[model samples]
Target: MKNAFVFLATGFEEIETLGTVDLLRRGGIHVTMVSIMDTCEVIGTHNISVNADSLFKDVDFSLADALIIPGGIPGSNHLNDYVPLKELILQKEKEGVILAAICAGPMVLGGLGLLNGKKATCFPFFEPTMTGATPTGNGVEQDGNIITCKGPGFVFDFGLLIVRNLRGEETVNEVAAAVLAPGY
Candidate 1:
């Protein structure tokens, strides 16, 4: 089974983060919720607390096929500030691993120069932060190994795209049908 790592820093968007995890899990993907913070309980922007499956330092990312980041205010900033996570992201990108982000999460990838020469999309206001990429206003945009979505409303598409990239179009179709959001 394809394994994915979803990083959760404090203040993450509860919908985008959990929705993606739920969707991917339904697709039969093994998703590990990783806390970039000191503890496994990371609080969301809306004050929802979620227990992560593992700490960032404890993960063996080398076995992961994809890396996901969900966006929310200070959460995105917090994710961008972590040196180890950034290094792992860069390494994953260089190795052609699927990198997915939504809302302000793409800004984190942008700051790392990973969006250079690619087409990306993020929460409307964050388009400017997408450094060297063409900022498309589409709800979701996938440029090679990188997949970006606009915001909470597009979380399903973002998750579906990630599934398509990792598993295939057929699996995405099956998963989408099961979720009643086929091609939405």
Candidate 2:
């Protein structure tokens, strides 16, 4: 099975992270929970804790067809500052890999020069940093291989998006039917 690497770091939004994991798994995509920290346990922004499958230094993110980043303060900053991870992000995007970030995460991608001329969206807090991002009130935005979403409230939409991308329209429709959610 082709893997989708969902990068999880400390201070991640629980719902945004979990929502994507659940939604994409339902669509039959192999979702791997990768830790960006030294340990496998990551604490969420809401004070919940989730365990990761592996440490950031241990995996080859390049094996992933797509890269996903959930949003949080300073966590976004942490992802942007990690040299190795940043290299992986740029390298993957350069190779036409699907890159996704949500909420403050778009700022992380923008910091890496991914959102310069692309139509992207993020949590309202980072709008000033986006420079020229197009706002999508609906939550999720796909700009080429860069997929973004607003925040936790939009996690479901964002996950459905990953489903649509990895599994195609037919699978999205089927999962949407199973999920009983309007947006798919």
lDDT of each: 0.93, 0.81
RMSD of 2: 1.6
The weakest ten consecutive residues by lDDT in model 1 span: 175-184
What is the lDDT, from 0 to 100, of the residue 127 in candidate 2?
75
Which lDDT value does model 2 have at 155?
80
Query: Model 1 off-target regions past 4 Å?
Result: 182-184
Give the clashing residue pairs of candidate 2, or none.
none
* lDDT value, candidate 1, whole model: 0.93
TM-score of each: 0.97, 0.93
| Candidate 2 segments whose C-alpha is farther than 4 A from its true place | 131-138
Model 2, 1-184: lDDT tens digits are: 5578888777887788888888888988888888888899988877889998888788866568788888887667777677877888889998888888888888778777778877788888787666556666547889898899988887877888888888898988888889887754
lDDT of 2 at 22: 85
RMSD of every candidate to native, in Å, equals 0.9, 1.6
Q: For residue 111, give model 1's deviation from the true position in Å.
A: 0.7
